[model samples]
Target: MAAYAVSIAKEDNMSTSDITKMLEAHADRLPTESGTTSFTLTDLGDNRYRITGSRATSKHFSRILGMNSPTLSSSAEIAKGGTPAPCVLATNTSPSNGRGIEMNNNARMTISGCSVQSNATGSSSVHLTQAFITVTDGSGPGKLCHGGGVYQANGNAVSATKELCATVTDPLAASLPTPTPTGTTYGNPGTDYSWYGSKTFQPGIYSSGFVANNGRTHYLEAGTYYITGGNFEAQSGAKIIANGPITIIVMNGGTIRITDYSASANSFQAPQTGPYAGILMWRVNNGSCPNPITFAGGAGFTYDGVLYFPGCLLDVSNNAHISTRSEFTYVLADRIMMVGGSRMTIDVDNPYGLAANLGGGGSGGSFALVK
Candidate 1:
């Protein structure tokens, strides 16, 4: 049970003139804004990179060359007397030039009994960044790659891409941002509700806890939503309507559970502008509690945002065909797992990044480093 709201901003329905003025102002800023549309991680030379986020404070990474070997293991069996649906990890942002998954440290990425495909067509090189790699009985990039070597039992493993052994300073947003709407309070902040109804959740701080287990549809408008020190859950056929680009923040030992929804009826789109741009679910807290964050998707589901939980475990299991239709997703957690018949497709072809050329156009859950 999680609930709290300091000040919330509802759909006040701005006037046409107000909308036009806002758009015009945005247009004026576009000419010189190097970090528009989404966050930018600019290599400031001298082994430094500056990350410009939307609502959160800017971050800088100096000497991020640590090491964590990433492992992506796969298992398959005959499903209902049919070939097991291919479970994959890929990036479509630039086809031959995006990372399907990434992580920082000396951890090695291992995969077996599945396939790893980038958008590159016809025997293109697979790209892995900053970590050791391992693959068995799976199809991945060729010998041309960055970081570690690829070993496939089926002879799909590429040569060693040479590890940079860099560390992701804070894969998720380092600084917690204030909510976007600083206007009014919607629900009572101190009370816990088993939220049910076809209503809307404005932007504000729900500091207690929030859960929605009833099978219902809800709309979330544009703004930042804060769920602090509690469990944020949504299950039992809950469908979300992402009315605008928004960010959902979970802080201070807050657990998250979002599952049991029809994927065909939902699509979680990240904000295209601001520090929260491209970030949908962000969990910022010290890794003290053992509670896990569970996120499962149905068939044809898509997540066009960054699921940032640098100090927590993110479980995307026990659900079938999750993240199969993703436009872009970035996962930065202390740990991540996809098992129990769960299937996912992490496409990194949108504005987010996988490989180099972070200018624009690419998508899917980028890898993160674990401690």
Candidate 2:
């Protein structure tokens, strides 16, 4: 009897479709017996379900069940079910070339179950510098086979052997302009200003810490915001909407933290040009311990600016979507980490182009390495 049951189970495993049909037919009457094996199916609600049974039956359950739609194939393909990643990670093909993600210095990137799609059609997905890249748990270039792979400056961009790898030069080496702090002392050092709650402000030097929280929306006019001391935070559904050009300068041990994972997460965007051209969040070297600058927002969050903080750690994640809806985005930080389903875009066909103000164009500074 035992031999007979094992034989029957092996035969049943050969055809997943048949097993699925049997399961669906008996959906209302789960925990049914199938050839001496009892299986239990529980509806998890919201079109999702969970099934448990003998090892042989549950093996390859998801693959055997199969998805109605295609999954993430490469970093260059748009996400089929979830939010599309902003960077391009596809390989290069004919006529149309694919853009790639670029990371620099000792920075690291890790991606899992995410699709890094190209900004445009027929472009590569990733362009990485001398950084470590890691991909695991079903992460890769999406859809298109060509122009959806890893292009590294030193060697193969991807850490996984199964990834499509190629050789490419670091395009961002020249574009990131080093900020030369120039100005007579504008504000006294060690001053603290806490601009909290909901309100609007004109552009000028903010001589202290700036905090916006409690579902507040702070509006800033076209100008520069100089944060002299302490940290800058926008949390708890807080938002900073820019009506015109704006720049945020974090100095004297000051940092920037944008948090709260909700759709109304703390969010803001800077301009694309002017005296602060190609620069948005600037943190000067104040001889203090480096702090992490966190950016968290919803899918509508689109930031166009250069985040220049050579003395700080950059944390960009949390279902945030920094679309390339504007001109471009450039950053120069001590270290960087991008994960948590965040999509930071670098549009390929934009009129302003990548780091245009800093004299960047055509594949330079266009890649980020995922470690």
Candidate 3:
């Protein structure tokens, strides 16, 4: 009957033909059990649930479904150049729960260093609060994910040995790319207006929001810089240059920080290919964090790409070292502050996989488990 009822919510880049078009749009307001295609449950929230189907005339899509596969989400074994490409995320919507990768500068929250390259694990990516989150600093390299939870404080431990994953699939927040772009809308360069003697900027849609007046030397002529009311800031400077596929989209408000603490001669670079190739800076999540965005990268900084900007509260301070040398970097925010000695590296292979295939974390259809 209409694929055994409908109402398959749980969105966020949903796929599988959008659940067979929502079970062809309801089976008499039924709502449970789907057989024509064999049961297909999906919730994946704290309680968790995601039972795909294949061979069966009907065993259960209702009755609370099922979760017998040695415990649905089981993962452990990834640390040597294998599954480590959500880039660098801390997408915790901020109710404050260990702060994902938030460090107070005691040092040791290196999710991938700038130089001493060796440890590059962090498979599930790293999220916190609800579940599946961690940070380590005992031996580095995520300590090969001991998965027992031990985020030592007092010394600011990120990994005395951390790793408790079962599915944090946020493969780039639904294939990202929506900074609101229509046509031409730029304004508000007030306050004695002076972008450091105009270096060169020709993008679009500013809408009463365009103020970058720090020790400047700007040059962004690539495309897309849709900044809303919140006057963008790249202060703490002596330089803030952009010479590539550029993109900087902030939303409703003001004083939204992007990069500062003087990355020295900041040299931004994204769009290595097209369609905003990894991404350069996107802070448009109007859920909260009124205006908390202070991202700094030091030592003559050279931004490579991808700084997603989830909900709010993203401040990676001081000697912030992001994207190190870029092999295609990424950084999701919504509560990420590895204060002072912040070292958030990038380069686990993104040759533009861009979420592998897409449908929420790419690689199409993905989930498979059979014995």
Candidate 4:
């Protein structure tokens, strides 16, 4: 599955060069609202192209994604719109192999203006936590959750209401693929760097590795990207635009470290079908090195897929957000942490649907009512 160059666009005035400049500049740090509406790409030779519109916005908020010493700041928050969905799914048995959220023993957490709120009825904001779910506020309710109304999970003695359910369980970790892609067979095999400028990427497996943000913008064609034997990193001033549903799979000792803070605002979504359906980023379970998945600083990092890192720590901070567009979104990890005004929101208007449709055992799950 080697990656090839792909160009898809409906507008003509926007030339390849102009697109390149826009991507490189990232104009307003994020694709302008109008720029993202009908985003497209103009072919520019080799494996390169330019952004066509404003990057869509998506953030993730589960009852609880996963936890091992998870930390949340007073500025942190977890919220969703439409229908109803749990803010954090704590227990692994809740659903989607406990895909919503989980915090095993030894996992610690800190919190502040953080809360789990929803608009829909019946659904609570939290699932369960093996570790203590602390609230940072000293005066007001120590903790908050939206279960139709604002429910106090933890608060000062007199104002305190319910307690977070503590059901400890060592949920099953995500199993590694039996037949992993052999970097040799799949996608385009090439070293197309977008860390300094603008470039486009086609679908397929990127066996070698991928890096962005030496100060540039990378445009990813609508398809699946398999990163093998290397790491996928995006730093300051790096931007990624997806023309359609996309999937990034990290395998063969490859890890994912995306720090699109302040400068780079990467916007990406995962495919809705196939083995990696609904998965925005899939970090291989490296038995030895528990490399963490760091997604921080991208105030406008829109993702509508599940970030499945069963054996790694998933840390999202610095005002990052994960939201759903057309489908549902979930985060499954060994441990999870969200701080610095980070948030996760789901839209029941377009929910993930039944658990069975979410694919595999731990791919995704439905939200359950918390007592």
Model 3 residue 57 lDDT score: 33
Error of 4 at 173 (Å): 6.5
lDDT, candidate 2, 1-371, per-residue tens: 11111101210001123233444454333332222333443433321223343312222454577833222111111111222222223212221234333344444444332223222122334445565555332222322112345456754355443333232212233444443344323342212234445456665555656666666667766767777766767676656677776778777888888776343433345655565665667777565535777775553355566556654556666655554423334444444445555545443224233324342312222111111
> In candidate 1, what are the lDDT values of residues 1-371, reduced to their tens digit?
01111111111111122222333444333323222333333433322223332322122332253433222221111111111111232322232233324333222343332223332222222332333344332123211222223223321223322222212234234343543434444443224355556667777777666565566666778887777657777767766677877778777777778777653656666666676666678776664637867766543365666666655655565543434222224455544444444544443322233211111211211112111
Alpha-carbon RMSD to native, per candidate? 20.9, 18.7, 15.7, 21.2
Alpha carbon lDDT of each predicted model: 0.43, 0.44, 0.47, 0.45
Model 2 scores a C-alpha lDDT of 0.44
Q: Which ten contiguous residues of candidate 1 have the minimum total lDDT?
A: 76-85
Query: On a 0 to 100 scale, what is the lDDT of residue 160 in model 2?
Result: 41
TM-score comparison, 2 vs 3, better candidate: 2
lDDT of 3 by residue, 131-176 (tens): 1223222123433231123334453333323434333345565666
RMSD of 1: 20.9
> Against the hidden reference, what TM-scores do the models get?
0.49, 0.45, 0.31, 0.49
How much is the lDDT of residue 190 in candidate 3? Answer: 33
Error of 1 at 161 (Å): 7.3
Report the lDDT tens digits of candidate 4 across residue range 284-321: 66573356677667645656666666556566666566
Q: Which lDDT value does model 3 have at 290?
A: 74
Q: RMSD, model 4, all Cα superposed?
A: 21.2
What is the Cα root-mean-square deviation between model 2 and the actual structure? 18.7
